[model samples]
Target: MTHGLHYTVNCSILLTDLPLLERPAAARSAGFDAVEFWWPFPEAVPSDAEVEGFVKAIEDAGVRLTGLNLAAGDMPAGDRGLVSWPGREKELRDNVDVVVEIGKRLGCRTFNALYGNRIDGVAPERQDEIAVANLAHAAHAVGTFGGQIVVEPVSGIEAYPLKTAADAVAVLDRVGADNVRLLADFYHLAVNGDDVPAVIAAHTGRVGHVQIADAPGRGAPGTGDLPLADWLGAIEAAGYAGLVGLEYKAAADPFAWLRG
Candidate 1:
């Protein structure tokens, strides 16, 4: 039913067979014309030469870089993000400049800002205060490059605050910035017990970006129990004309899901 939907591969989680710079080319080889990524560099801000090399890789691969996340802090080390942490405001603000530069270079319009996990002994209200202020800062910063900011609700994480679609919407409303919107990743929503189609039907207009992986296991479409094709149909039936990001792990030939 989602026969005509357009998709972009998130190279950060896919194409493990190749190095980071080569994944864009791999995506193009696998029939995708565009790709997205998490913050690619190990540091929040990498050197200009390093970034230019990333740009050149995408250029040489001939694929459009459509979406990118602002640095979320050592993801592998479990520091979910830096933007909302109380004393790390400087780090979060520093991250904005490079993210804006990359978006400008790639002509990318969507930027995702992940909310950091709640720090122990930090009140939720205090963290919420930090998050709102930080997101507003980011929204305006990204807007300078004509880019939109999106916040996502990641599931199975007790520490991160935005666990529902409503939670994400509240952040958007609190920031009250026209350029900020929801990420609406179906896999996360489903993992958190959301009826994906229902949520899509209700808040279609606010969904600025979408990411997908199947449920039970974060694998490609046909490898899990989610009605991915059906939900995608419903998403399209609503008004989202943006690209759906393939953000799942490469569990045994992920591209086969595309063919199926």
Candidate 2:
């Protein structure tokens, strides 16, 4: 089994809830070596200089900015995701590209691909087709920058169709790109009733990144009943040598809790 750990700065804690300027230092103080955000550069939001300064903060903090969830647009209200929206293709593509460029500037190499809401009257096979096509396009767009298009499967209210590791593998198979891989989120696995380590072991071939949170509460690593230490060991044992993002909320101050 492999024996090393690298933590990512999940935006849910490091950016989404806090102002962007405070994220990098907060992550570093929390003992994180890398950072990941769920859409850092929205078009209607900050300027290029502001975004670059954030990237500089990450570099100065000595943390590698690993990945970005590039699909926060479609889920505006509820039940929305990447492949679900019909005519937002151009906008979605643009948004994804904008973040990819920002991620490049921030020293990140992975852009997450999310499947949005379930469209009414669309067949499952058709959705798979759309997912495959969309992922292929997203992967190709990031491929030039030597970045990966990490496809994530959700199990909470966010889950629509591609909600399992096996399902995501199918999407990767269909997309047929080396740059595209599966993002196995532990909370999703637990909520979806999947055996966390087993799924990680099963998809070792295409698993690119892994995320962890408590089952039910989405709190810090050790807060849940899930056996994360062993599961983490299993993931490393199964040959997944990628970043495990701590995408959870802190019951207290994030850094204080970590230090304690």
Candidate 3:
């Protein structure tokens, strides 16, 4: 553990310099035994060969897959998620089985389900109804394998509605699924003006997973002004022992913070 916290490299965002399949080995070579990722596919359901190649890369890398995000629609195309989208329910539901199957193979029990952006022309209440229903569906699918689903509050996309821990938790409450929980991403929370320390103190029990990056710029720890170390300490003090994901944009050597 680094800094008294279990750190898992988020290969999805941090290791962009290499091809997707090569990232797990690079993270392993950097001394991280555990890794996490966003959906590493262009679509909700990838081909059988695509799935096999992804699983093989992680297996061959000798690292544990700790967390994985469910298919958040086309992320690079600014599709934050499908959970709350009006007509994309099937896409998200179809993706759940694939995510669970991959998790079963790689021993990952936590999954992040991004709440999609609010579309113009759709009533907010209507979107919320769909989100709650879809979230419950995903939760049951994962629960069958003893897995838990996490709903995250994203930053930087104004249309993406869940902006704070409270926002995400409200949705979780509505979903009313015991296995669905919050994904506390520190960078996003701070960027959206959350009370970081207080969030740790008040919601640790409800938090299923945690991720970190400095605010002002989603860069490595010290490149921005966030007191990440202190906040992580607060999380630990509050009885959170889950792996803290290093979900930042690398500015040179990503492992430099760990080494320092």
Candidate 4:
């Protein structure tokens, strides 16, 4: 049950009290050498200068950008993601290079795409088709950078179709893109009623990245009922050597939960 863990702070969710670009440095100050984030630009393709500034911030902070999310529609406003939404194909298409380019600069190889909420009046089949097409497109684009696309199953979010490893795998199958894989977030899987150990044991190879938050409150590890240390041990035991993204609501010091 012991393993070396490579932890990456999710800058988008953690260290929010500081400026967006400052979080990387803050994470470094706290002893982390790598970080990840959701899309930081409101425009999928922000000005080149803006991209430079963001990358510079990470470089200046001396933190490696390990993972990043593809543009999901205004996450602050709860758009979930537009990749599968009807009439939003253009938005998804526009972001393909934006994310991949950033990843290329940051040497990041993992990109997460959230499945948006089911839209009203949109036929399920059409939406699914669009999703598969978009996912396939992203997967191919990421593959150019030697990266992989990840689809995560969220918990307590009924609107999003992916809440189980099997569901994510099905999407991966539909896309038929070799680079697309499942994001086995223990917090989501446990809160959504899946056997965390069983899922990790079976799908270790397909889970390109891992994320964690305690169940019941989605708070920092040790704040809720999840046996996080054990779960992580299982993930490592299953042969996943990727960075584990620390994604949870932190009210105090972000590193408090991980310290002995």
Give the TM-scores of the predictions, in the order they appear. 0.97, 0.88, 0.97, 0.96
Model 4: worst 10 consecutive residues (lDDT sum)? 251-260
Candidate 3's residue-wise lDDT over 177-239, tens digit each?
Answer: 888999999999999999999899889999999999987889999888999998888888888
In model 2, the clashing pairs are: 80-117, 81-116, 81-117, 82-115, 82-116
- How well does candidate 3 score on lDDT at residue 231? 89
Ranking by lDDT: 3, 1, 4, 2
Clashes of each: 0, 5, 0, 0
lDDT of 4 by residue, 141-176 (tens): 999979999999987656888888998889988998
How well is each residue in 1-260 modelled by candidate 2, as lDDT tens digits?
13476677786464456677677777776667778877655442457796677678778877787877775563546644565466766766776667667766776788887777666786766766776777778888788789898877787554477677887788788888998998888888788877776796678778889888876687876676887778888888788788888788776465454455
lDDT of candidate 1?
Answer: 0.88
Worst 10 residues of 1 by lDDT: 251-260
Top candidate on TM-score is 3
- The alpha-carbon deviation from the true structure for residue 116 of candidate 4, after best TM-score superposition, in angstroms, is 1.3
Clashing pairs in 3: none
